[model samples]
Target: MNNEKYTLITGASSGLGKEFAVQCAKMGRNIILIALPGGCTPSLAENLANTYNVDVRIFEFDLTDSQELKKQITLILERFEIDFLINNAGVGGTSLITETSMEKIDQIMQLNVRSTVLITHMLIPHLLQHERSYIMNISSMAAFSPIAYKTVYPASKAFISSFSLGLREELSGTGVSVSVVYPGPIMTNSNTAQRIISQGIKGKMGLLSTAEIASTAIIGTITKYPTIIPGFINKLNHFLMSILPMELKLKMISRAVKKELI
Candidate 1:
């Protein structure tokens, strides 16, 4: 059996995903980067290879398509022995459910939930081939409570958090660890940074840089942490929500989101 190991990252083209790739490369790990077509992944892959001097392979396709995603996975497993699977690709929006189109809802569910599950399910066998393996799923703080303008997105992330924890228990003593990362807000780009700034205190409360979150998540996963929540404020927020009644938690989040929306 081939002993070569790799870290496979979804949505590796930009944002937190890109930072995760960079951090992994710095650790001298081989990478299999996947992103939607027509992005900067080609150039990013080239740079990582040149700078890190590690094997970096790039695959560009819409992960929302299950059939195409499966095909890509088959192709990936044929070439590399994956040791880490990072399900970081996701989409989100803020809008009233009544105003949100069905198409938009479907897209969020497909990418954030369906594709995550499909890829993880398909990669479990390959991940087990390695002596030690890790799976890191990117959830959000939104998963802890439901907000007014965001519904489906949070629900989808809730699924990720639950799924990762359950899978971790199931994979215990099997040399494979599953970790879920619940980041509050990531300054992924200039636009996101500006938006967060505009939101004032609420946005800055648990906000974290992409690099910080990525590095922490990678290290936590390697150490076999079941749930990784970056930033002290985020951890505190999670603790508070965990103890609150569902109705009160929802009310608090809704008020906070209302402030931002207005």
Candidate 2:
């Protein structure tokens, strides 16, 4: 009902997550910031609390662990009503499919896909209570193309992209909006991971600032757009892929990955 009861962001410790927290504060929104136990630096959180002049509650938990997930939410609800849920916590795991271990793949899926899905489900009731609420899932341009070496990561995002789209439809007319953000090579830790992935397909151009992407996503949610692909080139890439044959698309993606990493 008020700024103090609004805006909950997961992975609020750094990068896009941190940027989202700051932007929400600027909007005078009270933020429920969730991050891995050590993810958000104490200094950063205190600064946000000082600058925004709004209540900033920090929750630290391991999202991949279901038990911890619930506990964190329980603690959060003890203080405020949550309106916006940003499922932004994720990790970077890269390796060729054959070369990647199952343990690594499972870890990637757990954090990137399952945890995100679970947290969203857990917060639905809270969102429903608000006159208007939003859930923004942070996906990647990798969801648009296959990354051979980084098989699991892209696949996880693809799941999120599809999931968010389906959810947007389900929540339609419910006063709870869902927006999926497809950000290309954001200038964050994820981009750093891509650099290790290889060369020709390596991330190039000016990576969009985390603040820019966060602002765009937040604005998109406010405007109730179901799917938002930020950046001109990313939109172009999605357009190109949409019409391409499946085999050709796969081949193109494979070649790009090879060039990018090799």
Candidate 3:
């Protein structure tokens, strides 16, 4: 095994994934960034390497392709010692279940659920080689409650949250630590920012910047925090939502989403 440690981050071209790459590089950690094919990750890799003076490598591939993903990651593990795995690649959509096409649903499941699980599974042996390792999976606060117009996305995230928690327990005695992050709406891009702004006061309540979430996630992972929920308002909202009856929680979320769908 290579003695130098690196953090492998999926979806590192943009959004929270990009922020995580920046923060990790700032800490002087070598990085391996994976983004979808055709993304501008080469430039990002160059910038990080030059700015932080850390080793940065970029991989562009379809993460949803399970066979190819496994093959590529197997090759990666052979060449580098990855001490941290950040599973931040995911897709989200808002639409009625019936209106969404089968392809879109499959994409969400394959990328968000299948890829995350498969990559983690493939990397466990490599992680175990290290005296200390960390895994941080990005889940959404939507996992807390069922909502209309976003049926599959939230369910997928709930799976991530549960999977991370269970894996954390199973790997307890080992040197590896697992952390699940549940972040609310993040202003990742101008489009997402506009959508949140359109929601008026309701949107602002749970909105968090990508930098804040990334910083908090990195800190939490390094310190071995089991769960990382970034903002105080988001934590409060999660607490409030958790105590409500399931039916009530569903209804409350439905009402809010319905307004957005209109």
Candidate 4:
């Protein structure tokens, strides 16, 4: 019997996903990095293997493609017994919903909602096989409210929040702890950085680096925290949102996000 376990992280090529891989490797856990076909996961796997001296593997598959996702994920389960799952691959942008093409909307829903749900669904049995296991879903602070330009994105993340909390209860006492992370604006890439910079102070509020977010998320997930809103400022933001009227929050958030279209 193999006693070794693997932490499987989607979007492991860069950003917060990359940070998750790094931090988990630092924790001496073997990793299985999943990313798109042209990703940097191969080199990352090599570096982590040498630097942390832990086993690292890479699986490249576009999660948005339901057919490919099914094939690849099934193969992954058959080959590796991954006890930790991180559903981190997601996409969003600031554009008017009318201007957003059907293709674009489908992509967001597929990658953000469908893929995450499918991957988590397929992996649950494998997860239950372990004496103890962890599942961390990366949601967003955007999930707390509605925004105009980035409509579908927030809705998808809200689903993740609902799904995570519900699954946590369902798997309660079963040793499979499900936790969701709500991260504020992350400077994960040049495009994202530009977008955040464009928003000035408002965007900067509750900001945390990928390393900080990953560290906090990992710690929370391991300790079985059902919901992780990293950073004090983020917690404050959550509090503020909780108290605000939905109608006003929507208008404010919509107005702020409308600037991104310019």
lDDT to native, each model? 0.89, 0.80, 0.91, 0.92
Q: Report the lDDT tens digits of candidate 1 across residue range 1-262.
A: 1125889999999999999999998888889999988999989988988898888999999988889999999999898789899999999877778989999999999999999999999999878877888999999998988778888989999999999999999999898999999998877777567656766797799888889999889999999999999999999988978999999989888776655454
Per-residue CA lDDT of model 4 for 100-209, tens digit only, reads: 99999999999999999999999999999998999999999999998889889999999999999999999998979999999999999988888888887998898898
In model 1, the worst 10-residue window by lDDT is 253-262
Taking all chains together, each candidate's TM-score versus the true structure is 0.95, 0.91, 0.97, 0.97
lDDT of 3: 0.91
Q: How does residue 178 of candidate 2 score in lDDT?
A: 95
* Candidate 2 local Cα displacement, residue 16, angstroms: 0.8
Compare candidates 2 and 3 on lDDT and give the better one.
3
What are the runs in model 4 whose C-alpha is more than 4 Å off?
Answer: 1-3
Task: In angstroms, give how far residue 2 of model 2 lies from its true place.
Answer: 6.9
Order of the predicted models by TM-score, top scorer first? 4, 3, 1, 2
List all candidate RMSDs to the true structure. Answer: 2.0, 2.3, 1.7, 1.5
In terms of lDDT, the poorest run of 10 residues in model 4 is 1-10
TM-score of 1: 0.95
Q: Give a tens-digit lDDT track for model 2, residues 1-262.
A: 1345768888888888899989998998888788777654566668877877877877777777888887877777766788888999887644567877877788789889988998899888888988999999999888886767788898899999999999989888898999999887764775575563454334554257787788888999889998887777777778978899878988777776665444
lDDT-better candidate, 2 vs 4: 4
